[model samples]
Each structure stands twice: as C-alpha cells, then as structure tokens.
Target: GYNSHSVLSILMQTYMDSSTVLAPVPSFWGLVNSAWNLCAIGKRQSPIDIETTHMIFDPHLTPLRLNTGGRKMYGTMYNTGKHVSLRPDKTHLVNISGGPLGYSYRLEEVRLHFGSEDALGSEHLLNGQGFPGEVRCKT
Candidate 1:
C-alpha cells in the first residue's frame, strides 16, 4: 500500500532526475498516478487563458489590502527542476484582505515559471499571447 507522502516522494524523486525517460505528460499525469488523478480529469484547472475583453470591472470593488507588519520577509527558494518555488518562513506573517475576498488570507507559497525564450514561458496566456515569465502566489 502506498501513502500520499510516499507517492509524492516518488513523484518528486522521479521528476528531479533529468535522466528519467518515463516522465508522464500533462494529459497522462492522472492516469499514471492515483494521487494526480485531478490533473487529468479535473474540470476546474489553473493556468487558463485570460481573455481581456471578457473581463468585467465593478466600481463597487474595493482595493485589496496587503498587511506585512512593516517587516522584511525571509523565505527559502528551491528549484524543483520544473519551476522555482519559495516557501515563506512560518515566523513571517503576511496577510491579504478586502477586494473580492471574503476573509483575510495568509501567504503560503510562491512559484516562478520561465522559459529559455521570450515567447514561451508563462503558464497563462493573455489574448492568446505568452510572456517570458510568470509569477504565481498561492495562499
């Protein structure tokens, strides 16, 4: 029997190895591992294309508030072979409120994605255009 941690460890180890030839593609991620089933079949996934013309602006929307306690943040960055990730230290409390959010949310992790070329890096596309890099913040 395999646990979630073990499965993650195996996935991480396999992904970290550049020489591995059996790496699964995006469409096959869920088929190869039960833990990643959502990757293959999930209806609501991330990194979707954003069409600016479809965006609606609401004047009632308030400005988002970021509370950092006026202190510098410290975090450890890691290169996971696929992307760069930053996990903030627990001692650094960063929170965000207002805007469209109903409650205050704490900062969790940040991910950066880039490619060797200028037109091939971003995870999300804007008007069918890709950028050199993209930064994603997860909370």
Candidate 2:
C-alpha cells in the first residue's frame, strides 16, 4: 500500500543522512581488517574471523576504540573511508589490551553488503585499488 512505500522512503532518507547507521567507522573497520588478514593467512579461514572478538564496551553505542600500539602502523589513517564503503568487513587483527597496554582500538559495529550476485558496490577505493571487501580501522 501507499504506507509501505512512504515508510521505505523515510527509512532510505534517514539512512542516507546518517552514515553511522549504515557502517561502523575507522576503529571498528581497522581492527576487523587486520583480523581478516590473519584469518586468511591461517589454515582455518573457518568462521571468517569473528567480529565479536574485537567488540569493545560501550555505554552509549559509542564507536569501538582500537589500540594502535602507540604507533601509526597498519596505516590506520584510511579507516574512516572504508566505513562509508559498501563492502564486507574483512579485518584481520584485533590487538588486546590490559592494565598496561599501549593504545587500543575498540570494536564498533559490523556491516554487510550485497548486490547483483552479491557483488559489493562501494565508494571508497584503496590506493585507487578497488576491492570486493574492505575494513575500516581507527585508533
């Protein structure tokens, strides 16, 4: 009915206006990307590197923070761009923190993407390189 289309239009507008609702930002994506790398390297590739492993505690739905190990390694600077991308998160690593750990990255959220034949359609390109997948990492 007309109500269904109207509701869909509102939802679509809201999603377009609110970026976070669609995808998690740098911290979440970055850590996920790193973890994916490890999973792909190892023999398992089983569960596709669980996203909850990197989940960070948040009281107000805050974005998860990541521990960069006090360094700019992993090129964390580009994480934000990936968040806006329409691709599966393939993070490869998630550094744990403790009482005396350096910086940290918290898990934010997990986003799924699909297209014709599940083809990923994303806006951000890495080094002008398009990928079927991407992970947004941040500190």
Number of the top-ranking candidate, with lDDT as the measure: 1
| Candidate 1 clash pair list | none
Local accuracy of candidate 1 as per-residue lDDT tens digits, 1-139:
3222221110110121242233344556678666668768978655666566766565777887768789888889999987899988889877655674445666666778777876566777666766777777656
Assess candidate 1 and give its TM-score to the true structure: 0.64
lDDT of 2 by residue, 36-114 (tens): 3543356543223223436445454433344544654331222343344222133534332333222333433333222
lDDT of 1: 0.62
Model 1 sits at a Cα RMSD from the real structure of 14.9
Q: Which segments of model 1 are wrong by more than 4 Å?
A: 1-42
Best by TM-score: 1
Model 2 lDDT, residue 92, Cα: 37
> Which 10 consecutive positions of candidate 1 have the poorest summed lDDT?
7-16
